[model samples]
Target: MAGIYLRGKTWWGRVQKDGQDLRQSLETRSESVARGRLKVWLDELEALAWGGKPRLTVNAAMDEFQKEHGPTLRPSTVRRYGVSIDHLDAFLGDKLLLTVRSSDLKDFETARRTAGASAPTVRRDLACLSTVFGFAIEKEWADINPVIPFLRQRAKRGLRESPPRTRYLTRAEEARLIESALPYVADAILFAIYTGLRQEEQFSLTWEQVDLARKHVTISAETAKGKRERTVILLAPALAVLKRIPRHLKSPFVFHHGAATTTRGARRALPSASTKKDNDGERFNHLDRGLRNAAKRAKVPLLRWHDLRRTHGCRLLQEEKWTLEMVRDQLGHRSVVQTERSYAFLEVEDRRMAAHGPGTNPGTAAAQEIDNATGEPIAAQKPAQGRRTDLEKLKKSTA
Candidate 1:
C-alpha cells in the first residue's frame, strides 16, 4: 500500500513493500496532485518489483551506455558520440528516460535548428539520442522508443535535405588540375582517381598494407568504413604512383609529407623529407587547402577531393562498361543497388547512345541533306517503308 501525508509546507509520500519502508517527497502542496504523484511513484515501484522498467534519467542512461559501449567504438566515433551526448544533455539531461515523449524530441530538434544546426547535424544528434533510448529499452529502463516514430514522421514530410552531389572530373579537367597541383597532392589525386579510395582510407594507408608483388593494398576491417576488410587492386597508374613515392624511414604512412616550413621563404620538400614527426608521423592530413589552391591556379572552380574518387567510379561505369555488381565490389559498396543508384543515369545515357547509333540521331542524314540549287538544309523525311508495308497488308486483309 502507498499513501501521502501533509507535511508543514509540502506533501510526502510513504510506501511499504516486502517488509521495508520507502518514503519520498511528492514535491507538491496540492492534496489531489500529491495523491496522483504518489500513485504514479507506487506504480513505478510495483512495476520495478515485477521486473519492469525502473525510473531512469536521460543523463544516467547515457552515462551507462557510454560506459558499456564506448570502449568498443573507434576513437573518432567515440568523439562524435561525445559531441552528440553533450548537445543532448544540454536539453534533456534532467528529464526521465521514460518521460521523453515525441513532442519533447520535436522541441529538441527545434532548439537545435534554432541554434543554427543543419538538418543533417540535428538528425545525427537525434539518431545518437535514439540509440541511447534503444539501449535504455534493452536494459528495461525505458518502455518505448519515441524517437523512432518521430524520425519516421520527419522522413515522411521530407524536410530540409540538400540535393545529392553527382560531380565527376573529366580527363582534361583531371590533367589540368594535376599539372597545377603540388607534387604530393598530384600523387594523392592520381591514387584517388585510380583506386577510388575514400579520403580517410587513402590517407590512413601504410606501407605495410601494400603488397608490391601482388599489386594490391589491403584495407583492414578496423580502418575500413564498412568495418569489413577489402582489397584495392593497384592498376598501372596507381602502382606507378606507389613506385615514385619515396619511403620514409621513420614514418609508416604511405603518403607522408615534410614539415610546413624548412625556412621562411622555402617551400615544403617534394617526394619525402627527413623532418621530425610524431609516433604516427607527419602525414598529409589537410588536403583541401592545397587542392583548393591548385584548382584555383588551374582555373577550375568548385573542385573537391571527392570529385577524384567520383571520377573513378563514373569512368568505370561509363567508359569501361562494367556491370553494376563489378563496380559495387570495386567501390567497396556492400550492395550493388548503391552503385546502380549513383550511376544509373549513365546507364540510361548509354542505352540512348546505342539506340541512336553513336553520335548520329535517328534521322540525321535526311535532316543534313542540302538542296543543290538553294544550298539550304531540307526538312528530315520520316521513314515510310515499314508504314507502307503495314498499310498494304491491312488493305489486302480487308479485301
Candidate 2:
C-alpha cells in the first residue's frame, strides 16, 4: 500500500516494500493524478518512486534555459532575460526547485521593489522566472511551478501596470529636434518618424532591406517586433530623406555613425565592413546623449525614440485622415485594439481642434461648422469668434 499527501500544491507519496522505505513527490497537484501515479508505481517498476523530481538548483535551470532557448529570441530580449537571471540568481542562489515557496517569491518581489525596480519591471522579471520554471517543468527537473500561483494571487489583488504614455511631437517640434540632432542621430530620428519604426528596428536597418527602386522598405520577419514581415511604403518625404542619406563606401548600415572627436559620452568609430551584416543582433545603441542634446538645442519637450513612432501615427491619422486599419497595417501592430488605444486620441483631438479652429480654444466651434462628411470642422483663415451653443444663441437673439 502507498500513501500520498499534498505539499504546497504538489502530491508526495510514501511507500514501503520489502522492509525498505521510499518517499517521493507524485508530481501533480490533483488528487486524481496522485492516486493514478501511486497505483502505477505500486503495480509496475522495480524501483518504487519518481527518483524524487531531480534535485536541481534555480541557477542551474537558468543555465540550461540559456543554452536551450536563448538563441531563438531577439538579442534585446535575451539581454533582458539575462538581467532577470542575475536578479533571481542573487536571491535564489543554490535553492532547490521543489523547496521554493510562494513566500520566497513574495520576498523576492518586495526586495526587488525596495531595490528601486518599478512594479512593471519587477513583473517582467517574475515573468522571465516563470518562463525558466516552465522550461524546467518540460525537462522534468521541476514538477510544481511556484510562480504561477504567486502571479495569480497578485493579479487578484490588483497589482497593476502603469498607463501607456501618449507623448508625441508636433510638426514644428519635430523639425527643430531633427535640425538640432547630430548627423547620425538626425538620420535615425527622421527614419523613425517617417517609417514608424521602433528604435531597434530603425537603428538596425541594413542596406539589404532598403529597396529605393520599389519605393518601399522591408521589415523582415525576424527584425520586426511583431515577428511578422511588413512593408513600409516610402512616401515623398521618406524618399527624399532616404535619397539625401550619404552613402558609405564599405559599411552596410543605412545610417552610419561618423566619428568627430573625443567627447565625454559621444561617438566611437565603427570598423568598416565589406558585406552587409544581416545578423539578428541589436545595433550599437548610443542615442541617449545625442537625443538629450537635440532636445536641449531645439527647446522642445524631450521625446523618446518611441515617441517618433507615435508622431508618425499622429500625423497620418490627424492630418492625412487614414483609417485605423490602414494605420495598424502600416505600423505593423499586432491588432487594431493597440492601434486604436494608443492613437485614437490623436484623431479625436484633431477633430476637436478642427471644430474650434486651430487659433481658437479647443472644442469652441459652431456645430454647423463641423463637416458632416469628414467629421472635421472647416477652419477659417480669419479665426471666427467662438461659436455659442443654441441656448446661448436664443438668449442673445431674445436680448
Candidate 3:
C-alpha cells in the first residue's frame, strides 16, 4: 500500500508505481505533520505518473478555476471574483499551490487588513483563494485545503465584521425628499420605501412582473440575488405610486428616464470614443444625479438610494413590528438571520417596552423618539405586529 510509515523516529512515504519502488523522507518526526507531507508527496507522485504538472502555481490554479466555473456564474459575480483574484494573486500567484501553508494565508489576511481592506473584503479574498485551493484539490494537484482550516481558526478568534450601515429615513425626511425629487425619481423613492426592493430589482422591474390586483410583485429567480423566486408585497404607498405613474407606450420598463433633451457639450467633448450612449425610454442603470440633486434640495446629508430600501425595512419592523422571518421574506433575503443582522437594532425599543410592561407602547407612552435621519424629535409612529392579520389591518386603515 502507498502510504506513510514511521521508520525509527522519522516519517517516510512509500509508493510503488510502474513497477518502480519510490520512497521519500517526510522530514518531520510529528505524526500529524508527516501525514500532511506524505499526502502532498503522494499527490506529486501520482501527477508525475499521469504526465500532469507535479507543481501547480497559485495563479495557474486560480485561472483554471475561473475558466471552469466562470461561465456558470453571473457576470457581476465573475467580475467580483476576478477582483478578489487580482488581490490574492498579488501575494500568492507565483507560489506552488501545494507549498502554501495556513500560516502564509494568515499573513496574507493580516497584510490585506493592514492595507485598509475592510473585513468583508479580506473575507471575500480568502473565499476566492479557498475556492482556488478546492479546485486544485479536485484536480489532484493539491492534497489539502489550507485555507479552510485557517478560516475556521480565524472564525474561532472572534474577528468582528464591520458594523452594517443603519441609515434610514424618518417620515418628515422622507416627505421632504420625495417633494424635492424629480417626478420619476420621486415615484421610485416612494416605491422603494414601501417595497424594500434592491436597486437592481427596482430598476430592472417591468409592468409584467407587477400584479397590482394581487398587491405584490413577483421577483423572477433569474433576477433575484439568491437565485430564487420571491414575492414582494405591495404596501398601500407602493401600490399608489405604481398606479399613478404613466406607462410609456413603447417602453417595457416601469421606470424609464423618458428622453434626454438637455445638451451635455462639456461631457460630450471630453472623449467621443470612450463615451457610451445611454439607452433612453428603457431601464435606468442609476438615478444618482437626480437623487443627488433631490437630497441637496431637501438638505438631507449623505443620503443614498439604498437608504430608501433600508427605510422600508426599518419602517416595517419599527412601524409595523413584523417578525424577522416576515421581513426576511419581504426583503427577499435567503434567511431570517440575514434580516435580523440588518434590522435587529430596530427591536431595542421593543425590548425596552417588554422591560416596562406588556401593554406599554413606547412610541406613544413616552415622548417622540429622536429620528435617526434628521436628528429631531418626531411624532410617534404607530406600530403593528405579525404578518397576515397586520397586513389586512394596514390595507383597511390605508383604504
Candidate 4:
C-alpha cells in the first residue's frame, strides 16, 4: 500500500513493499495533487517491474551499436569513439539501460570530473550516450532517452575553452627538419608542406590522381575528409618533389611500398611484391621515429605532424598574392572560414609586410633623380648679380 503524508510541512509519498519503507518527495503542497502524482509514479514503477518485456542492458546495446556502425566512421574517429565507450562501460558496469535515472547520469558526471576529465571530454561522453540511447529508442529497445535532457543541460553550459595555440616551426627550423629527415621520408614531408595534405592523404596519394601537365592532384571523394572530391594545384616545389619519386611500372601509388588504399582499408590489403617487407616496415617505423628526431635535431619543441598542414595554410595566407578561397581549396577545407580562422596568425605577418614599403633599389633611385621637368639633373642656380655683371662686361667690351 502507498499513500501521501505530510512531513515538516512538505508532502511525501510513502510506500511499504515487503515490509520495507519507500519514500519519495512529492514536490507538491496540495494533498489531492500529491496523492494523484504519487499514484501515477507508483503505477509506472509497477508496470516497469511486472508488465513490460525484458529490456536490453546498456552494455549490450552499445556493443551492437559499435559493431554495426563503427566501420563506417574514419579510423581516427572510430578509435576515439571506442575509447569514449570503453570509459563509459568501465564506469557504469552492468547497469541496466532502462533503469538509468537522472541521478545515475549526475553521478557519472561527478566521477568523470573527479577523475580529471575536461568538461569537453565529459560532454563528448554524454553525447555518445545520447547517440546510443537514441538508437535504442528507434529500435524499440528503450522507452525514452535518459541522456537527452542531460545533453541539453551540458549544451547550455557551452563548450570549454581550448588550450593555447601552440607555436609552429619557423623557416630556419623547417629547413633543419627537412634536411634531417630520412632520405625516403623527406619528400613526403616536403609534399605535405607544399600541398597542405594530411598524413593520411599524403600516404594515400596515387600517381593516377596526379596530372603533371596540369600541375594538379585530384583527391578522390573516398579519400578526402569531407567525403567530396577536390583538386589541389601544385606549386613548382611540389612538382619538383613529385618528379623526384622513382616510378614503378607495376605500382601506381605515389608513395610506394605500402598498400595503396585508405587508412582504414590499408590493413586489409596485402603488401605488394615491390614492397620489400622488412625494408618497408623499417622505413615506416623510421618515418615515425625520424620525424620526432628531426624535430629535436632542428631544436623545434612540441612540433606535431599536423603542424605541417597548419604551416602550409599559414604560408598561403601570408603570401601577398594568395586569397582565402585559394587556401580553402588547397587545404581541402569545407569552408573559407575554417581556413581563415585556423590560420589567422598569417594575417599578422601580412600586416607586418604591408607596413614596410617597397625596399630601396639603386636603379630605381637613380632613375627617379633624373627630373622630368628639365630633362636633366637639377644643379644649383647661378646668382642673378653674377649673370648681370657678366652681361654688362660683355656689352662694354663690345662697345
Better of 1 and 4 by lDDT: 1
lDDT of 3 by residue, 1-399 (tens): 588888999999887887888898988899899889877877877778777657778997888998899877755678889999998889999888878998888889899889998777887788889888878878877788888877777876754355678777756677667766656677788988899988878888899999999999998887778888899999999999889776877887888755221221111121223334535467787787777877777766798888988988887887787888899999988788888888777677678777887536443244234567889764422112122332344456555
User: Against the true structure, whose TM-score is highest?
Assistant: 1
Among residues 3 or more apart in sequence or in different chains, the pairs in candidate 1 whose N, CA or C atoms overlap within 3 Å are: none
lDDT of 2: 0.73
TM-score of 2: 0.69
lDDT of 2 by residue, 288-308 (tens): 676776777775565677887
- Residue 119 in candidate 2 has what lDDT? 81
Worst 10 residues of 3 by lDDT: 261-270
Global CA lDDT computed for model 3: 0.76
> In model 3, how large is the Cα lDDT of residue 97?
85
Clashing pairs in model 2, backbone N/Cα/C closer than 3 A: none
- Judging by lDDT against the true structure, name the best candidate: 3
lDDT of 1 at 264: 27
Off by over 4 Å in 1: 1-49, 74-76, 259-280, 348-399
Error of 2 at 374 (Å): 37
Identify the runs in model 4 with alpha carbons over 4 angstroms from their true place: 1-54, 109-123, 137-167, 248-251, 256-287, 350-399
lDDT of 4 by residue, 104-137 (tens): 9889988998999888888788778888888887
